[model samples]
Target chain A: MCGIVGLHLRDPALYPRLGELLTGMLCEMSERGADSAGVAVYGDPVWSPPGHATVTVIGAVPDLPDVTVISLGETHVVHAPVPVDALVAAIRAQLPDALIAGFGEELTVLKGVGHPRELAATFGLAKAQGWQGVGHTRMATESAVTPEGAHPYAVGPDQCLVHNGSFANHATIRRHLTARGVVFDSENDTEVGARYVASALADGRDIESALKSLCAEFDGFYTLLVSNRDSFAVVRDAIACKPAVIAETDAWVAMASEYRALVGLPGIEQARIYEPEPERIYAWTR
Target chain B: MDSMTIVMDKGVNRTLHRLDAGSVTITEPNGKHSVAVGLNAPLQVSIEGHCGYYAAGMNQLADVVINGNAGVGVAENMMSGSVRVNGNASQSAGATAHGGLLVITGDAAARCGISMKGVDIVVGGSIGHMSAFMAQAGRLVVRGDAGEALGDSIYEARLYVRGKVASLGADCIAKDMRDEHHAELRSLLAKAGYDDDPADYTRYGSARQLYHFHAGNEY
Candidate 1:
């Protein structure tokens, strides 16, 4: 069992408030699973891989983009949080041929292993300031925990997804995704779903249509939270083995594993909160 | 009686204090479990909200009151006293009990009072499947309909039904509610706070013909 929280705000200047909002929700969501935490943020220019350029995301970040081979994880992050354009340029510098194609906005993904507080610190997640951030706390029933095991997993640079509950027929689904050149990283059902979704949308399918296809094809108990630059989506599998609640207002939309987490947010008193029905897909504008 | 109040939260973990004949009321904001377990004395406990499984199991004390619905096995093995549920109860409400009384105000799910010794369970609503399965002793009173295989292998315990009996267990048969039986029903109902007339119910028990079973005697 794990818990996921996704927040979308109409106000981006209020992005700094996410440090507090995500931290609070992660605390309560810790009950679902306490192993790890992670979050993905959408800023101003969405980074896209160059169509013909050689795209190689080293396991760590490195020094020079074309000549030097950076380990898959270590890229020089801007210590002082800068504006959206600078952040996007810093990201593009990593992959010389990468362009701003899909999400015409800046995005930040921070995740790591350990408890929510611990992982949040390791990745400097709560230190981040942005709007429309999604986070997850893992319990580690199906997948083993590792640096790659933390959630809000990025299927690609833009597509990130988190989930709760067992995903049945994972082996069969994994085989298909791998065949489609969607690389599998951690041995998690959610990772398979994330990769499949990103590849599908990249292959020219709308977000809703791709998600519906995944729902129709996959069998399991899951409440999935997915997001990109301009929008967010939520879908639950046929059987609701896990619980997910959403609190919405004109000001913002926040989702968590339980009702207690939504107790006192801005507009919370006037917010309409509800548990998402089993097997329904809900997508909204960012 | 003014029972002692123990405010329990995350700070209190493992090893619940037993209460014997002592009256206590619990207002658990966390909605915890094992409130009053493994007690030897006759204590009465009133839980304010929904309780997790096994509320007053293996009781040797007095009565307990659950203000809300109970999870599985409200009284697992009752040695004595009584357990009263103000709301519904889940499967195996009283399984393998030797003594005491269990009163459920609402419906009870499957397998209520399986393998009874000398206890009495009174449910005001319908019971789910496999209730009274292998009940050895005591009495089960259901005011509503019984599900499939009502008493799979019933023993000497008496079963009273106010509604339809879908099916009966092995060695069990619908019995005539004689004068002595009616008096027993009246006493129990009165004790459980039921003001309904006695004649509305029917009693079911072992034919006693299977008290010493032969393979040929079972159906």
Candidate 2:
């Protein structure tokens, strides 16, 4: 079992409170999954500065003086003044073995092994400002209990995906994707799900069609929360064994594995709360 | 009547652990998972807000009510007692429940009452596709429309639908509405706070075909 929480702010005024609210939501899910926690914050200016590309590399890295480096434990964020391709080349040349979990123009994915509350604090999430954030607390069913196995597996540009249950045909799909030259970072089943969405979006499929394709191809239980630069979406499998709830207000759209993760949001009582229908795509845009 | 109220925050164990016996009122439920599970004492639990998965799983001798929407598995494997969802319920609303009265005031999503053994489920609104799949024994009453593939692979369990049925599952055939069924459905509707005439409903059950799979049987 794992816990996934996401918040997409429709009002610009609520951006500053994104991290604080998300931290509470993640911490509340500590009991559901205690092994590790991860989060992807969108539109964090310092982490993903305007016009610059950002890369999230797992583990410590030798500082490249030209880029702005922010270290949170072993996780490192390199915000380069140049485009994303240039940053990718520099990282490949400097630290070839460093696992780049995600690189994007508007997202910064940070993760670590510990209680979600402490990880949120260590990553400076409370101070981070973003229009959207997605977090996960993983119990490590499909893969090892490593930080890389933890979720908010942001594989594609400005894309983030977190999952709560196991995928049955992930290995088969993984082999299929690998044959097609999609390099993977971890053995986690959720990583396969993220790669599938990334590949779908890369192929020019819209969010709804990509999610529908996921329902057609994958098997087993899953409740997925996916976020991109301008959209937030959620979808469940046919069985929908995993739990997910969504609450939408004029200011924001929030989703969590359970209701407790959502209760802390401001004006929650006024929000239109409901569970996403199984095999149905619920997507919202900025 | 005197009632004990427990305020639940993020912790689920603590909230359920406190309900030893008697009437209980739970406020600020905040969608915690597995609330009020395995309760043997006769009691009534009123959750003031939304709830998460398995809100009253494996319950016994208790009536649990949710004021807002419920996540998946609202009353999974319930042995006895009743669960009332004031708002909508997600998939598997009464999955594998053995004995219970589960009432959903709002719609129930896909696979509601899946694998139900002996529970009685009544939905105020529509139920999604493939509901009551592989149900062994129970009674499902849908006041509103039922989605595609209702009561697939159904066993002795009886299904009653007031609105249109999108389709019936394998071996599940619509039967004539009998007088005895109307009396039973009327009692269930009354228990679920509905006074609709049971005569307006249709009855469905397993055809006893495909009980034992022959070679090349189409599932």
Candidate 3:
């Protein structure tokens, strides 16, 4: 079992409170999964400055040749004036064994192996300001209880995926992706799903179609919350055993595994709240 | 018969369990699991906000009202009395319940009344897929539509759906709504405080095909 929460803001005025609200949602779900936690924040100026490429890595990579590295708790953020591909290649050459938590133009991913609340405090998540944020608390069902096994697996540029249930056919799909030369970071099932969606998105499929393809191919119960630079989407398996509730208002769109994670949101009493149906992709594009 | 208000916190269920007969109000439920659960007294509970899993589970001789939405397995394994949800209910509403009436005024998510033994569930809005799976005995009344695979492998349970049924499960077929069924449905609707016409519904039950093992049946 895992806890997944995401917030996509529509009004620019609410962006400053994005992290504060997301922290509350994430902490509320700590009871669902308390072993490890991760988060992906989009449009954070301090973490991922505009007009610069940023890559978040978790390892002992003290100094890179050209880029600036800032340490935030257990994860490290690398910023370079070069493009994303260049920075990624340079980082790969320098820290070959380092795990790239996230890499994008406007996204920064932070994850660790600890209680979600403590990790949030260590990362100073409440002070973060972003337009979109997705947080996950992991119970270590498919993988070990380490930072590497934590969720919000950002496999693609500016894309993040968090899952609440296991994938039964992940090994088969992992083999399929491996045959097509998709290197994996961990043995986690959610990584396989993230990699599949990333590959589909790379193949020019939209977020909705990519998730629909996932529903068609993957087997097992799942409630997935995926986000990119411009869109936030949610989908469930055909059976939809995993729980997911979504609430939307004019200012923002929020999703969590339970309703308690959403109680502290602004205008929540007036929000249109409902559970996402099985195998139906609900996407909100900015 | 004293009236009191209890803010939800740890060990609150124990306090509630100690109450024999009183009117208790639970505020700030905050989606906590097992709220007001396992009540055996003649008490009245009113939860002021949304609840998490198994809210009012194993209820007996209590009238519990949730003013907000209920999470998974609301009123599961209920013995007697009634549980009412003013908002939508999450998955497996009244699952494995033996008796009592469960009223969901809004839509119920997947697997409503799954494996129900003898509960009476009334859903004011639609129910999601795989509802009433392996139901041994019960009465389920859905005022709105039902999702796919309703009453799969059901046994003896009567289903009354007022609106569309996406598909019926295996061995579950539509039956003629007789006069007795209309009367029963009318009584059920009245109990659940609904005024819908009984003739607007269709009854479904097991065809008994899976009841007996057949040599030709493939695994």
Q: Which numbered prediction scores highest in DockQ against the true structure?
A: 3
Give the better candidate number (1 or 2) by DockQ. Answer: 2
lDDT for position A16 in model 3: 91
- Candidate 3 CAPRI grade: high
Full ranking by lDDT = 3, 2, 1
DockQ of each: 0.07, 0.61, 0.86
Give the whole-model CA lDDT for all candidates, comma-separated: 0.70, 0.89, 0.94
Order of candidate numbers by DockQ, starting with the best: 3, 2, 1
Candidate number that wins on lDDT, 1 or 2: 2
* CA RMSD per model (angstroms): 9.2, 3.0, 1.3
Writing each residue's lDDT as its tens digit, candidate 3 over A1-286 gives: 8899999999999999988998999999998899999999998888888988999998787767777788877689998888999999889988899999999999999998999999999888999998999999998888888778998899999999999999999999999999999999999999999999999999999998999899999998799999998999999989988899999999999999999899999999889989999989999999
Q: How close is candidate 3 to the true structure, as a TM-score?
A: 0.98
Q: How well is each residue in A1-286 modelled by candidate 1, as lDDT tens digits?
A: 7888888887666676776777767766776788777666665122112221112231344454332221213322222233334444555666554322212234556566667776665545555566677888888877777656667667554667888877788889899878876666678877778878888888888888989988898888788998876778888865444656677988888887654455546767567655454456788876
Candidate 3 wrong stretches, greater than 4 Å: B215-219
DockQ of candidate 1, scored on C-alphas against the true complex (2 decimals): 0.07
Tell me the tens digit of each residue's lDDT in model 1 across B98-142: 989899999887788888888889998988667888888898888
Native-vs-model 1 lDDT? Answer: 0.70
